[model samples]
Target: MISQVVIDKVLSKAQETASHSWEYGTVFEALLEYRDPHYSIFHDPFPGGKIPELTVEGVEALRYVKPFIQTNSARLCEGNGSSSDPTSLCIPALLLYNSTTSQAPDNPYLSAVNRQLHDLLSTTPRYSNGAISHRDAYPSLWADFVYMVPPALAYHGVFTSDIGMVKESVRQCQLYCEVLSTSKGYWRHIVNAEGTGSVKSDDGAWCTSNAWAAAGMARVLATLRKSQYGSETADEQKMLLNMTKGILDGAIEADTDASGLLRNYLDNETWFPEVAGTALMAATAFRMALLEPGTFGERYVGWATCKLESVSRYIDEETGVAAPVVNSLKEGQRTPLNGINPEGQAFVVLLYAAWRDRRTVAEDASVPMAGTDASRT
Candidate 1:
């Protein structure tokens, strides 16, 4: 488990990076002090905003993002544009709702955003069209992006007591799983409705994508257990268990480094110092091991702890920034992307929070089989 102090430091740095960038309510790819932050709705925005920003960052970020969602939602609703990529519109709405949930009862903005996301997702045919198109788009195939949208949707559904949204969220996740999985139980990095490609590209079997899948499945299962779908339904439980096993198996088979930390790409031997992907995998795997210590239990726990320790060594104590790794391959060589990317930082924060939560439960001996500990793993 990590201490509150450590989590606070990381959040502070991430918030600082976010503040310097475009205040569009979305997360950015990187925040170079010398350059402008690169923002994107598909892959960059952190689902959860940092605390300091929520309290003091004012409504600048939220306000900037508000119009984007409203305009997109109106366009989709009016049938003038495509809602094929629901996440771009859905995620920001979810974030705004989360921001206002604790305060401001009856927040019209949050309510409107939620309604728009629900409406678009419900009416969109591409979700269940059973055809593969838009392969290059992040929402169309990237595993992490697919892994992210559902939780936000499911969370809002539960908060608003909308069973339909909850069901749709599960359906979306199931569809993603079906499209992304290979015969070997490993999910392809690049996915589409037709099939998943086995060839490792320049990116390799991305660690973050797999981690996101693992964490997302775990969250979905937990939510279902609490919902109308309980453990009595063996099929649902089995699906969750199978997804967990698949993720663990993939991580073990894909780890190319002997140092216990996972490689960014399986075929590429380069080491990038960025902590986003690797740290997320470690944290997610560690949480899973604690929750269900069966079969691959020891391996998940041991590898996760080791990887976390290894990553900790690379963090620049003075800057709180995790350095990026540069690939040496001619085709992939480029300056490593750096600064505190919000999406990356969000994973870091969630890991610490989950670790701490688990630790507290463990000390009290009240943790379940899949319990989380907030203390150091």
Candidate 2:
């Protein structure tokens, strides 16, 4: 397990480095769900504990994240462009609405949430097959969009009891997987499906992109399983679980160096071993293990432990920055060995949070429940 001191340092550095972009949004979600369990959307023991009265960390999370949501909710309501990244803010907006005391129909935050949702579903550019485009200029698909858009849509579906939104999330994931997933089980980084976009298609299976897809699938699955819609979405959940496992197992198999750290590009050993993707991948594995201990418990959790240990070696004790990552903003450029970013820091916390949850559950399961035999053997 990661020490509390390291988690604190990473959070501090992440806050310092994060901008009002997707990176910051990633950090915000990590802090909200994992670090501050009070605000987590998933059920207890899956990611966070029960929602309780605001704690100090919870208050800090609100203080830090509320401004971003408030400021962008209004701006994004304009539906000006095709960038899907800002859709991430919708989750935080819905989370805020859920926690608010006055949930009246006229609530400004609620209106903001509706507007953001409208912009995503109605204004966003999508392909003929219904896959949402990642960029504004053309019909492009990015592995990162799996994390940025679908999970938020699913969560909104849960809050509003909109089964259609949930189904749309499932459809989006299926379309993205069809476009990105290779026979090898790894997903390619980006594709300009229409070929008209200026964005280049990245053929390499970038490690972080795969991590994003897997983690997002896990989040969507969790939302479905824990929400009132779980029974109806059972088949969809199974599909997501299988897809997530395929990506994870493929990435793990490609770690030929036995470094527990994957290359920046999973198949290209020429690139540097990276920490950000490794952490997120490990985090997702722990989550998968929690969800399906009978199928994934032993294999996924064991690998996740090894990967987290490897990731810890890269963290600077003084600065808490995980290093030697691909430049997130320049992923299509094939750049490697960049300085640490906020998402990298956030991934570390996510990995640790998953590990901690796994450990706690294992310990709880080991002890005898009330009126149960303590030592039958």
Candidate 3:
């Protein structure tokens, strides 16, 4: 019973919020309307620097709605590679054109993008068991980047006809689960990289940053299903599925009000429900439900739908703006109804797109699978 009409309406609203990221022709640039006043950094210019996180979400939004826009392999690769990270949003968008890239492997654009992805996996620093070192500025393994970058590398294994990358993606997930999860299995904010410190405890499980892991896992599962590598047969895939279930189960248990919205920190007594984290969790549930309906997907879909209802209260009807999205754990204060961040806007797009895609499949079992639509644009 998913309505295309409602999907269209929701997509329009989210795109309005996310459109600014592309408007200035750079991943780092944010539109005037969506800017947060608390941070002076968003306005700073990056001539060719990376905003791998924002790029990942932006690239995903493009894939969801703009499937038809990528006719040229080189052009599509260039557009998506906003300073590539393995979990760079560019991976999904660019990989969508794998068929096209194969047609022109010698194209300099394809070569460069492909080289960038390859170089990341080959050279990126890692700790024991393959978790990426998140401290570009210092030494630490950010739980957020665990989901942000590695999944793309794993999916890259699929895009380039490699199964090893898929295994690598799962290993990273296992390391992330080991490092970031609570004893009860909920996500925590950050963990010291293997070399950074001996402290094994996560700094704290801030809701939104860990939500990045949920969203990343959801996408990794979706991408794995598309590969010829028999993703289901892999040991890594099974571990990932189990970990995902654990994370969601913990989230449900911690829903203090049973009201769909999750608290900001799992261990603390804060009563506030975080907007971006809620949306990410909902998206994760809906996506997992789509991935495996009998194995807790249905329950997740319900959780996602309920959580989305609570989150929608924060989004403005007229402007399509979502307020009170805490920008980052370090910089963002949970000021309810304050300014919006571009990532928050992107998550709105992601929530609608993920829910719609999964629900459409649920309601119409015969509809073509997600990546197979010949005329999807």
Candidate 4:
């Protein structure tokens, strides 16, 4: 676990710096930062997306995104204006999670997320076999979509007592494992949703997208522990067990750096280290360490701590700014460490929250598994 000192001084400072520094910020960025949203301020002017998008099934994935119209220009809930895009689903789910649970009256956010989840039951463009559509633009199944929407639903399900929602979240994670993963091995970036693509893209194993997949799996484990999902069936137990083992074991093999940080693309030749993905790996592995057993679980906790330390280079002592996070990765091209990538903001904060919560949970083992160790605040 990370120290309380680091959480207060380092992580807090870094997150504060990021809110000021990041550019091209969107609601997706805010969703990750969606902790303790002051409604009066959220109602006031803020920079976030307001456009609704459609899924391939023509379902308005952002159909429920509402404006905090008490003040103009503070469009709190917006997503890509495409048909039923999975990537856009995270924003609405988060908005609902933020608004409905508080002393604040249940806003449209919950109803919106609930609608999208229902539409997802039959729509969302699954391959004939069953992996959810990554994006409408891609004909292939993307591993990145694992984190695009599922974790949001996982939390929503647990909070709302909606067992079906929880099951769907886990089912999506399993589908990814079945269609995109290699047993006893690491995952590939893109699979043939239509079964047409080659085994490897020039992009190779993208670090953050892979991190998203692992995080999504870890999220299901976390959710089940927190909610009344009931004792896992033999199959459920095996699935979670395999997902936790596979993700951690594979990442350990690929993290070939002195800093104990991961490269941008795990199997690519250049081997550039990036912050967002490594932080995500730390979050997922550390979270899993608590639930899993024996040496396997213990190793994850240690590995996560080391990786968090590795990224300390990106955080400056004077300003606490985390920088040099890669903007994005492409099939044959590599993006430079541009501005503070929003992904860096999202995962780094999440990593801090996860580590901080573990210490609290450890002290009170009596706290139910359904309780989240990681809070946005």
Per-residue lDDT for 1-377 in model 2, tens only?
46779888987888888774567668876786566653455444123322233423345565667666653354332223445677777766655565545355765666776776676667667876789888776778889889888888887776667899988898899999999999889899988866574657888999999999999888898878777777999889888988998899899899876556888899787777888999999989988777766557566767788898898888888878777777887764456545667888889988888887766756785743211233221
Q: Which candidate achieves the best TM-score against the true structure?
A: 2
Q: Where is model 2 more than 4 Å wrong at Cα?
A: 45-58, 71-82, 101-106, 332-338, 366-377
Query: Which tens-of-lDDT digit does each residue in 1-377 have in candidate 3?
Result: 22334434434544444442122121211111123211111121111221122332333333342332233342232323222222254343443333332335443434544655554455456556566665432234555665556556665565555677767777777787877777766777766654455555356667776667776675566556545555354666677678888777877777775444676665565545667677777767766765666575445666678787777776666566665566543433545535555566556555765665565565564753333232121
lDDT comparing candidate 1 with the true structure: 0.49
Q: Each model's C-alpha lDDT? A: 0.49, 0.75, 0.53, 0.54
Native-vs-model 4 lDDT? Answer: 0.54
| All candidates: TM-score | 0.67, 0.89, 0.70, 0.69
Candidate 1, residues 256-315: lDDT per residue as tens digits?
Answer: 676545666543467443466666666667556544555435566666666677666655
Q: Which candidate should be chosen as best, given lDDT against the real structure?
A: 2
Worst window of 10 by summed lDDT in candidate 1: 29-38
- Candidate 1: list runs displaced more than 4 Å: 1-6, 19-106, 118-139, 160-164, 192-204, 231-234, 267-274, 294-296, 325-335, 366-377
